[model samples]
Target: MVAITDKEFKQLTEYIKVNYGIHLKEEKLMLLTGRLQKVLQQEGFNNFTDYYHHILNDQTGQAVVTLVDKITTNHTFFMREADHFYFFRDRVLPFLANTVQDKDLRIWCAASSTGEEPYTLAMVIDEFFGKDKVFWDTKLLATDISSQVLDIAKKGIYSNEKIAPLPKHWKTNYFKKHDNENSVLIDKIRNEVIYRKFNLMDTTLPFKKKFYTIFCRNVMIYFDYKTKIELVNRLYHHMEYGGYLFIGHSESLTKEFTKFKYIMPAIYRKE
Candidate 1:
């Protein structure tokens, strides 16, 4: 393995936290080294400092992309959080469908790791709207910082294990066999989600229209309290009044740092 010195680890962690909002602690030194050792070996870089310099000096941005991909974990599956989807379908969708007169539903899966969450949302929307779905604009925006995961999300294929948590009807309605061991989401469901490579740390969020619901789940645990609060505030401004935000169940937001009304354990409203 390529050994990273204390100085090198600090340099890399600071760069990541400043640019990507991911706070790496000293304990993650081994993990960081393990994940990047092969990349360093292949690139002919003997030390983390040289690799860091290469990343900084690379104008194409691919180095940074690869670094982020290596350091981040993108493990997700269909209907990973069942209750949130239930609430979205039963409570959130009904409210939006009734209140929004324009018939345009804007939804964003902000940390869409490998496409399961957004696709699940699309399926829920389709099932809820049923035949009337043709009349509304329900296309979803799914974003992730890692291009590698975004590419996997775009393909919309999953193994049987990944697809297991979904409802049976969903299996029949939304997916088709990819081979003996996997299935791919039908284009109808796949097309409903638009994937983009987005870093939540960007100072300015680029969106012309505010979203009704944003699912930024499970990724914020990497950020420190300050970064988390700042991102929460940014998301608040990008959402419509009375919009809902669903974060990871393991995460929480206190009233002291954010204005979002706590609706439940992991859900908030921009009321």
Candidate 2:
């Protein structure tokens, strides 16, 4: 087992947080050491310090991009947390569909990891509006810290296993067999989502307008308290009045954010 001392640990932690919004805890050095060792070795670097030096010296930042890609937890699938979609359909969508002027609905899937979550949202929107009544402006901004994942997401293809939990109707209706093993998101639904790279630490976001719903789920568990607080506040500011925030089942904004009233768990509304 490779041991991580304080010096190498600090270097990598700063590198990760600076490049990706993920803040590594002191206890997580083991995790960093283990997960990153292979990346370093694969690149012919001896250790984290060498890797850090390489990234620091690379002005073009392709090295940092690769490191962020290697470190980001992009493991996700379509229709994850069926209950959230249930909440969206039963609780959230009806409100947006009826109350919001025009049939346009905008959902931002922050930290959209490999496109599963946003694609799932698009599928649910498709179901709600029916296949024929598809409104053109029903869009989703699928953003992640890793450009590499966003690139893959923009292609809108997934293995059958990645979409295993989709209902039979959705599986047949929303996707087509790309080959013997994978499925591609049908053109209509895939076109509704726009994939882009974003950093959570940036004080200003790229969006000119706010969204009706934002899903930043499962991405905050790695951040420190200060970073978490800043991110939560920034997300709060980005939402329109009555916009809904859905986070991971394991995450909560209770520690730092008091503006949001906890709606269930992993769900909050700007109040």
Best by TM-score: 1
lDDT of 2 by residue, 1-271 (tens): 4456699899888877865678777887676777767767777876667777898899998887877876778777776767888999898988887777766577899899888899899888888878544553788888887888888889889999878888989889989999999999999889989888888888888788877899989888978877888888888888888889999988887844558778987989986
- Segments in model 2 whose C-alpha atoms lie over 4 Å from true places: 1-5, 131-136
Question: Which predicted model would earn the best lDDT?
Answer: 1
- lDDT by residue for model 1 (1-271), tens: 7788899999999999999999999999899999999999999998999999999999999999999999999888777878999999999999999998888899999999988889999999999999999999999999999999999999999998889888899999999999999999999999999999999999898998999999999989999999999999999999999899999989999989999999998999998
lDDT of 2: 0.82
The RMSD (Cα, Å) of candidate 2 is: 2.1
lDDT values, one for every candidate: 0.93, 0.82
Q: Could you tell me the lDDT of residue 218 within candidate 1? A: 93
